[model samples]
Target: MTELSNIPHALKGLNSVVVHPDFKFPDADVVLSVTGRCLYEKQLLVDTDIRSNHSESGGASTSDDDEDFHSQTSRDRRKEREEKNNPEKPSQATLFKVHKSVLRRASEFFADMFSIPQPSNQDTIDGLPIIYMHDDPIDIHNFINHIYNSDVLHYLPLRQSTFNMMSSIIRLSRKYLLLRLAPAAMFRIRSDWPTTLEEWDKNDLQVVAITRWNAQVRDGSQDGGSRLGPEDLLVEPCRVIRFARQENILEILPAAFYHLSRLSSLNDPHRPRSCIEGRKRAHGYWMGGGRYATRSVLTPADWDTLMIGKAEIRAWFVNFRQYGWQSIHATNCGADDPSSCVLSSQGGWKNYWDEVIGVQTRKILAQDGLDVMEVLQVLRHVVLYDENLCSGCRVQAGKIVGCARTEFWDCLPDFFRLKRPNPWGGIWMEGEPVDCFEQSI
Candidate 1:
């Protein structure tokens, strides 16, 4: 039997996986043999040179082309001989001992499969029937663990490795029609990458706090070692974008795309290199003077979507800067000189934007255009707390912010050229959040 190295350790409180069949499962009546081709197996054969050393003879008539042809012919002959001599080789496989009732209850595919009658000649391992599964053993292990341990879904939101584990379960569940498991996994992903503006604002505040902490660390005012990064609080948007597109999770794409757009270093392969150094603020950020490349890149279509969405976002900012406060009426100003309050405060706001906010936006973002959502938050704070602005203007500014954020969230799908999904912003109850998983299940 061939041995496979680097088998993962069993997850906490779960032990349904084994690299070999020798390990016993007293309660398991069936053995699931999961097999996959070992990529390393062909490396030795491919690296070995099949050519023989030629003799150093001036009179030797074998041309260089002839030698090349002969070398390839010898390699082909050896491959044929090996194939004929060994028709089959033992493959690397993992054995999973699990219950039929658990599988049937979890998956429609397995339920239907178990309902079929089996032949008496079927292969058995240790007097138990062997079921061969072609999926990755890691996926199978996670799938079985989820079925046996209901707490897996219950504690999913709190787990640091939620994306990897939940995504694996989602892939397997979708394939096998595991009704309950997929919805739970989907709910967790959506919750993490919110669809509603209200929920996204909550997540954004956490990101802002992390950025502030990181900023303090960078300026030598705080311990550098104690700094927090965006990845600590949220999944990388590039990975989320790919996964959402693959699973048809339209609700998450707006936030994912918006998150990616805020990054200063997302570059078009066909575009110039002006913003490569700006990656420090985005997905593949720089840390401790070293570059850490993000794992995924957007597809061409996604790149187009990002560009369009960014253009729209920057355009919104420009429009807001020029005319967002035009609706403010002098009659609503609380100052004794209402006209002076309205005109002076408006002038103060625009001047502050041009001199401070605009310059800072240009400096920080560099090549990437304005981060519209973040700037909106900044605008909200400035209007509310700036001493120059009257209380009346502050209240009106709050209303404008509320309306703009809602409009932006609603138009995100249109911006990205995506068809909106049903329950786009999630279904909320009167005072409690509904169990989306139960309804879908």
Candidate 2:
């Protein structure tokens, strides 16, 4: 009894004293007791009695198990009942279903707003809900914004003409004109001016030529002199018009204005005729005046009929697929080998050689050719192009050409050298040389 009392007193002292500053009292004592119990059990000096009690409710309870089985069971039952009763329970399928409904509603709302009937054949592709509107530029722009903002449309493929038409509508609306013009000025500086000049000859190229010629004429003559050189005479707007045709300006100005109008109306809600009926009415006035027009609007019913037409949709798909295939094949063929036939390149090979080779390679290799190197190259091109090579492959091709002697073969993957020589004879795991006797002769 005295020994037992001394043992308890010794345990209290051990529990009270901190083993380490980081270690707490109750936790350390509990750990030490558990360790001792485990050792005693291992030595057969003490047995760990894992007694389980079968409760009156047919539930089992174990020693040291703090969880109340009755309470857990009750809670689970309540949750099940709540889930069954609740109509708005969050679920993936439900969320998707709700999204689909919301998109449909939004489409209907916009169609009504524009006085255009929705496409009857409204369908979903790969979880993306599509709403086809009448090809009215304003209505189309609004619809694009609507779907884009709502996150209903995942991918949009618009015809170039359609995009241009919408842009013109936006520009004429006057809401985004200045902002649109700002970007247009930059674009003119970067691309349009250079391209236009390249297309024209000396007589046709007026703006830059006139400006330069005038400056030269001013510099060549005395400061206040009125007498001009032949170049200076050419600098006059009247002379420039006569050199070209006045009709060219008339033709170009309307088209430019049309596109500008479309661009300006893009984000402006206050812009009138930014809807199907409004655009159609506007077109009626414009067309009645005997002006050359690229597009004419239709009634809501007519628009819906057009949108739902199988042939039209099929044509769109065909064009889109062709364009995508051409773009991809162009990249693949033009890549590395500059001489290869790509659609973007000037006349080289008559057909896509890379695609032909790719098909044959697949038949031979029995696997996809796009591996880690191809993936890495794609990533490198996307990320490193602008920073390193102005987003053009010309510099990369040049580098390859410069490093052709040693780096060319080294750059190629092991699989590409399937026919390369194995010095260990036929016993080696690696393949034979590409120009081996069996392959060559």
Using all chains and alpha carbons, the TM-scores for the candidates as numbered come to 0.63, 0.15
lDDT for each candidate structure: 0.56, 0.27
Model 2 vs. true fold: TM:
0.15
Candidate 1 per-residue lDDT, tens place, 1-441, comes to: 222233333211222223322122346677777764321211111111111211233221344433332344336546545545765744345566556887888899989988999898776655677787878655665566566655646554322245655667788876799898888887888877887877888866756665555444555534422323323433557777888888878778887887777765543222333465433343223232111224247788888988888877666555555445443321254567766564355465456446644664555434563466666676667666757657776766666655565666666665566666665743443344332212211
RMSD of 2: 36.5
Please tell me which predicted candidate would have the highest lDDT against the true structure: 1
Instruction: Please provide, for model 2 over 136-210, each residue's C-alpha lDDT reduced to its tens digit, 9 standing for 90 to 100.
Output: 322323332333233321221212222232233333323323333324323322221121222222323443354
- Give per-residue lDDT, candidate 1, residue 210: 52
Best by TM-score: 1
RMSD of 1: 15.8
